[model samples]
Target: MTGSPAPVPDRATRIVVVGAGFAGFETVRRLLRHQRRSTDRPIRVTLISPDDFMLYTPLLPDVAGGLLDARFVAIPLAESLPGAELIAGRVDSVDFDGRTLQVRNREGAAETVEWERLVLTPGSVTRLFDIPGLAEHARGLKTATEALYLRDQMLEQIELAARETDPAVARARRTFVVVGASYAGTELTAQLRALADEAARHRGTVPDDVRFVLLDMADRVMPEVGEKLGDRVLEVLRGRGIDVRLGTTIDRLTAEAAELSDGTTIATRTVTWAAGVTASPLIQELGLPTEKGRLIVGADLSVPGDPDVFAAGDAAAVPDLAQRSGKGADDAITPPTAQHAVRQGKVVARNVIASIGVGTRKDYKHNDLGLVVDLGPRFAVANPVGVHLSGYPAKLVTRAYHLLALPRGANRMAVSAAYLGDAVFPRPLVSFGLVSADEASFPRSQGIPAPDSD
Candidate 1:
């Protein structure tokens, strides 16, 4: 009895991160860097995601418009995240009280992993509405697959239009409708217009025949960049022959047409729904208090009652301490943008390390660093550090900003080469027919659950 006392098992502190978007990827990278620098307490880091790569989503419009190859924008998690256990799985649920997660791996097998500390950065999905035919025909630019599919679909439609005997059918095939005049929708409209123009030149068709309609409920195109800059973007878009409809939105969508709220029905085969995004479904399933579908967390990103849990990015409603000077508490939250997400990721990493006794905790605070909108070749609108610029000068700042923002060196080089090639040569107009319509649908690509049929 004296010799047989059971040997207690020893386990290192486990930290698990969910999702591989900008926030999660950056958090994991920073955490590993901290771990490498310090020889302190032994801790195991694990990243669980359905994808094995971190997608550079800001460049998705370029991919959709055939400006860049798809592979270059994807950063492989396994290679970039050394010394961390990469689990290819989607977390189905989390037992917050028990400190365990129920994950369904790529092969659809259920597994459970315990975590002493957890970071939630599942990101956001396309905010869908109850409009008819939307879920069936509308697509988004959130994933690389969707981008590739959009490129192929556009080319295929243009090719089909070239041989069509019916003028009405041809017009419908060439028409492209994009909702949401914000960053993603605006950039996509500009790039796709360029793509359609190039396709028109090769087909010996009038570029004007290819119609582009950009819609938004907001009064201005991109209100985030202030009214003056937003007005400049509107001017550039309209000057380039895009139908920029402010204070407008789609009422319904169909495979062949989109019905606008203003009683206009646009006949089109493609509808890119870039309206906006809401936090991932997992946040709602947690049964916790949320502000506008995002988890409520302190300025330091820690969950209210759960000290071991932290959330950032679009999934978390992080207080905007930098802007909290005179605003109400409810109004002082960071807008869910890529810039904020990237900076928030770093803060989350630092705090997570501190929670495990490796360092001291710090609150997240950052001022607005301006915005950039690339409107095709030789045209852009940028406000760099509060100085507004338009046209060619803005274009230079926009490109440089992207190149610097891209994390991987290889990606930056590849993107730079693509830009140079774009300047020197005509774009190739061909579709490989790789992604099917069903495959690129929102339910399949962006993880939106199919609505219940009545």
Candidate 2:
């Protein structure tokens, strides 16, 4: 007599991606595209993230300054990735050895997912240092909610100032302080100043009276962009009456003002901390090798000693092939910028497909394409393909580039219409009164109230 063995259930190869930023979104999209054309076997693709939309971070400043609507920049993930399973939750912990993940939804319900391949693109969060009172007072520019909160805060301050007759209180309401002169800080500073200037025209105070201070620890503003472009940006900002403080840091932050390391204190009601970003704590929990908080990955974007795991974007410390001496030289690392993240996402997708025997894996190698800083209409600085362009022409190039880079056609059209409308008509100077103290602070996720609940 022969005994029958148990029948094994059929299962599709499951691919799970975490964090729906530029990197994770791209990876899922590419894999689904590949799976769509394949006729051999079934492949399952799932994206797990806290938010249901993929934010277009480049245009966030515009939304904060009321140049573009918030809806224009946030693309619905479900619609964007039609065929993939979208898990609306934050990953609590990952079991790499078991190929499983523990995720918790907004309602505190938890679930576990098992996958054949895993991609980690949990983007970095606002970098908080040991500075006193910073986490309590300053706001970040990472998400659409933060940007909208900032916009409402700015407008509310202006409106409150309009009702006050006291010179000191009015001045405090009109003043705005932003730290970090890099891409986010610099761009936000410029846009906010423009917003204040326009709104001031409709109020009692003149544009020149509105105070804006842009501070940075680096000697020159936007040094990463290029020396020439930095100088031009500095000039434009200065010409707009923005107090650009180079080689400075915030000594202390208060509800009413910011104390600079240079012993100068600026009285202001608004403080924005775009200083920098650090990798999310989720990466550290994995106990993987990391450089400056970013998980280390190889040339193929695969995590060391874990062939099935891969990482990219701000969460991964990818070696810069262009900056390195040769194959083994791992001294230089690629910057955690949107440009690199987008390309890394593509490479990781290709390699992930190759891992499942669909194609061949390729190493990630890309040169810096250049940088563009939009300082509102008729004012921008760009070094596209190593050619310097500034002022109006630069603005046009910058807008065109954004339109091309935006993920959705609807978003691109909305942004374009907003740009045109901005040129023709003035933006409304009003606040929605939606932002609260908890929603407008650094390190907000831990105990702060959710935006919708509040």
Candidate 3:
């Protein structure tokens, strides 16, 4: 047996991580970095995601405006994440007791994945409520496909607005209503408005009269970004000719118009849904106790009553006692943000190592490192280190943070260069229709037969 290597184990202790978003990506990153292949039995980490890349969702607004390379946001799983099997598919459910997951493959076939330890980072989906006609008329900007679609729609609207001498159709094409004031919505509103405004000048017919309206049910823009920055964002949006509508929402979405609750029906064809996100339905499938559609876990990031099960990211309802629990408050859930997700993922990995007999388990704890909002080229709002910054400096910090957060180091230089290139020669305003103009109001397919009881 001197020359021959030892025979491999027939059954490996598998660790399956579902969803390759912020949580799943970092979880796998930590596992591979910490685990030593020679001394340790190969930890079979299988990551199940619909796409091979982990999308940096915050920068999706830049993609929509064609300011950043669309491919820059996606990190291919194969680039790193060694020893982890990456499967491209939608996972239906996980049977906790059986330690198995039911995932549908590329060919729409089902396969069973047995695991010793499971990390359910199924992430969140866009929350689309029943707004009348919105499903038929709106254009979403969530996924890469949606971003591309919106870009085409914007360019289409500009061209159409240019061709039309009709005052009504021209105005309709110019007006855009964004039904959320969160980071995604705010950034999209600012960037797209800037892009369209520039295009309008070049085309001559597309209006300098182009308008954008950012609406939210909350009293202030970016309610999560705090009142100070929210006010600044409101100002920034308004400064860019984007009408900031607060404490308001769309009452009805018609084929050619959006009727607002404030008795304002904007005649427009574009409505971007960036209101919020809800946890994946896979969490409910576990038959485990969940807090607000997220798996309820202890500080250790492990599922309660189940030793092998773990959860993180937007899917996990992490308790926030540090920043939340005040004078009269009871239990408070952590805000579903990327900052929390990244920190929680590492903690999850450490805990998983403990489960695998590597080291001691540690609880997830993160002090808030404030948020940054990218509002087009030179305009941005940031509250880094609890210090408020607006205009240009904030934009610099925002871009830098995203560059640093990107999965690959190569992407950093490339992303930075593009930003510089845009500063020099702006990207030509053009759109290729990828996702159809038929907008989607619902997050997932309607009447999917309850996803099958299997």
Candidate 4:
């Protein structure tokens, strides 16, 4: 959507990449790498994302717990990738037949964008259930703002906990409950508990009696990784004084407590929900066949009926090793994870280039490369390269992986510095006051991409 290119960039050669998460960022990065090479017809890649930065969502909990600074999690888009047009807007809908996308600018106005190729890698959003009073009362840690809020709330909780004369009310104020035992929930609970411990220790007014509870309906933590890893994480969290409540759920939630299905209620002022993620509704706008809201795609990463359209990330249902091995009987699609998304982005970029005649297409394939979950600082669990690693070694591998995976320059250093700073001092607190639990409840919209005016 710009003035005619010097070579008129054949209308069919234009690609619009939506979302700037791990998958989208890698997609654009891989594309730019390819574009840098000499090509007969140059490709123009425009990236449309709500923010002009790629958020390091993996370390977000650290930010909340005061273990890292806010800036550590956000890498500006332009600085990360040189050639791609990093637009600061969001895509609203897709016109599959027209090969166009609709977007809303920061000003709330809508525009239509035509593309020769469209890659949707919008990624995941926080999931909500119908549990009473849960959405309104509990805060979310999915975004940077949520992290900031949780930090402020932690410090404020310490202050409030120290003041209430009634022991029960004070105990309720100090108790922090996190729901969901998946990676995000476990990591966030562990980190925040550490932060609370450190912050309380520094204040000296907060007591060792302060409580942290992590509740989930599943029988084990990290269920996505299977029972073995789940047991390991549960032990780690419980060892840190976190009450691990498995095979449980909050039947009712009040502003002050979560009533469990066991008929027992825990009084607490703060509830953090990291239960899981769902595909964005943007995929629904395509009016294409889908499985569980994710746009269904072929092995080549193209929509079955819409060749001009492509999708990856949590927004897509992609085949996995299990699926291909079984001849599509089980059709075990890869679950959503950063490891797969990064690889998928590379494949998607090549396929988009091939589709536009710049090269040949490649099918996407990758089994899990093992996973790393950092629980607090030196405590972590990783099955890296197929080796089960825990304690300091796992922590080292986890940090290194995230550092290497981060998109931009000096960000790795900045994040490392923040970690060091947190070690020496309490986590710094900043308040954006943006996005309430209510606003975040609704799924975000991806906007039409703007021309690379930057």
Candidate 5:
């Protein structure tokens, strides 16, 4: 299973992990391996999270575009992590001094659990602003539910547009707008544009010239990548007829259209918001030192002055030791990328073990390998170890990296089959209305009422 069937530890040494994203998952995984090899003590590990699956977020755009099935990206926690105990619940708050966590589940039940060692990897939530009607009108792409819902919405809009006799109504329904030029927004825009291209061919009445717009407040698309690659990506999107607007954003969003800051408006029914993400709200409730909503931890990934507590991933502002300044500087917080999170997770596990006197701990340090952006099946931009590549070779490297990085199992096979099958057959357009977003959208503030003015 996930861990060795050793004797259970007493309540005092119980290890409780607080998330199931890349950081927490890797922490538990490394703990299991070390526990199996050690005879020092019974390492009782427990994981508490809202969902039982660790979503492989990189392939979410492909899933939304019908290039891959939803099941392929959802790695089952119970099956993959048998060594650790799983508790499906949402953490409300943490009492650092008391070493207790208040958690609530889907059934509206709340409970408190005490632990000896606490690992906080609560991850992050979508970053939203105070724009009017933006929350109600725009959809997020952080979770699987959002991805699936967007797919259905896209299909339903196209279907409804094809039947509309009014030309103006049809055009409005065919138009789609996406805000955010980060990897998530850019990939979503690129993949969905590919889907829309093929979708138009099936319906004769719907104009083949369906409009797709990409907007961002940044100066260029995917500023995370090099300017050369960003320019190339911008050129590619423009060549494919995607209206790429930079240094612009939505001033006001209505159900019918989005008003841009430049006194322009676009009529559309679909709006996907992928602008940014912030640390999970649960982190702030802990009363720990924080930098911009992220828990501040030492190079060892342990909370300052709290030897029993550790934090990592997007939830923690871990210092980047590989930065220009050798000392941990205020401006050298590690970037919230999957690569850093994965490596940080492993380091947290080792440090936690060392906290229990099992082994020695090392400082969290690593240089970035590179970045890869999947523009589409044949187009990609990548900088692997300072070497930049684009087009077919970049696409190949991008796909290979994902395949190698994804956890091995039936899910990997399913993902591979879906990619191969897309070339042999028409991509599936069926939209089974199975996923919903009524309660899952913004997790931390859900069901909580605003405070009354004194």
Candidate 6:
């Protein structure tokens, strides 16, 4: 007879959340809070991400423009998410039938972890196109590192342009092209224009030589805020000497120039591609039904057939109950925005807890709280709760919204301090020299493989 049978494994329920963006971070935080209040069952919360900090991505343009410190936007997960196991890794694949995940840690080791419940919030990445030389030369503004690199790159280009004996070379270096005129692209263009102006002054060069070109295929700038406010934003940008081009985009980009769709080519050394974002590549690897590259989930933010699997944020196509019209339910899906992601995180957390027999599940439904666009100093556009405001009032509302939206107390304080310092002192123009060109490339920083890669 055998001496003993195999020992039974721990029966505690395990919940694994992937990605630490707004949705995943909020989901983990809310779940941990619930675990502390309830003592009926044992629950293990695990968060798997490549980085240990959750990035407040809305402030990335500010960081890129040197208005805020990069460190202030990154919230340490270990400190913020207490009572949860933090695994530093990226999920490579998911075996939905087996209820397990294949993850590769920072050290390049692969590991398999089983989960009782799974939450997918691996947020979106820069939406790349098949345009030639795009992945090779274009830079993204998604992560903190990318933002810092952009700041340094802008400064470096300005410095180089100031000293070069060749006028053509200087002009090319001073010219900046920004694609996509939505929130990220618009904010980035405004902030960068200010930085370039200040840097040009410090370098003893003509600020007018430093040109910014903003391009978007849409007919208006920031149409999300409606026509009235959008028109105001366009006027502000034009007043700042930014060449805002509507109904136009880059057809091709090279190290020296960008060819526009309108059959015009401009000399430029830096091209910032803030075009758009699509769901993470991992979402498509599962062979699940997707809508516009995002995993399709029901109104309750749960997969149709898989009850234990939940999804939210940019990775999931969630139904917008608030906007449901007489047309059809499929016609109104939530737009992928940080506001929606944060709210969806809270709803997903409650539904997950309900699945574990703690409470009843509820559907996710929220109306628009309005939009805010910060266009450099003393200039902004906002429609708070359907009230349009521009200029100084809008600026105040925009800043207040950001400060209040930031989760951590320390981060908010640090950001506020940075803003105060910016008012009193000149913006810093020195490059840190920490991130290299290779290190900041799209393939290296954002983890998006090249087009030719298998």
How many pairs collide in each candidate, listed in order? 0, 0, 0, 9, 3, 0
Per-residue lDDT of 1-454 in model 1, one digit per residue for the tens?
A: 0012112224556889999899999998998786576655666778988888999898999999899999989988887887778888888899998999998865779999999999999999999999999989999989998999999999999888888999999999988999999899999999888899898888787889889999999989888788988888888889888998888888988889899999999999999999999999889888889999999999899999988999999999999988886454646899888899999999999999889887788999988898988889788888988999998999899999999998899999999999999999888776788999999988789878887642
User: Residue pairs in steric clash, candidate 4?
Assistant: 90-446, 90-447, 90-448, 91-446, 91-447, 91-448, 92-446, 103-447, 103-448
Error of 5 at 153 (Å): 0.5
Show the lowest summed lDDT stretch of 10 residues, model 4: 445-454
Candidate 6 matches the true fold with a TM-score of 0.96
lDDT of 5: 0.83
lDDT of 4 at 401: 90
Query: What is the full ranking by lDDT, best candidate first?
Result: 6, 1, 2, 5, 3, 4
Instruction: State candidate 2's TM-score.
Output: 0.94
Residue lDDT tens for model 4, 241-314: 88988888888888888998878999988888888777875776667888876879888888887777788988
lDDT of 5 at 171: 82
Tens-digit lDDT string for candidate 5 (1-454):
1334346646426889998989999999998887778766557788998887888888889878878887899989888887787887888888877888888887879989888899999888777788987877777887888888778788888888878998888888989999998889999888888788678766653434688899999999998788999999999999988899999999999888999987899998889888988898787788778998899999999988998899999999998888746645647989888888899999999999999888798999898888888887579999998788999999888988988888756887887788788778877777887765453344323322212211
Better of 3 and 5 by TM-score: 5
TM-score of candidate 1 relative to the true fold: 0.96
Stretches of candidate 2 exceeding 4 Å from the true structure:
1-10, 325-330, 445-454
The parts of candidate 6 lying over 4 Å away from their true place are 1-10, 325-330
Q: List the residue pairs that clash in candidate 3.
A: none
| TM-score of each model, in listed order | 0.96, 0.94, 0.92, 0.90, 0.94, 0.96
**Better lDDT candidate (2, 4):** 2
How accurate locally, in lDDT, is each candidate? 0.88, 0.85, 0.78, 0.77, 0.83, 0.88
Cα displacement (Å) at residue 251, model 5: 0.9
lDDT of 3 by residue, 101-145 (tens): 898876789888888998888787766677777656665666777
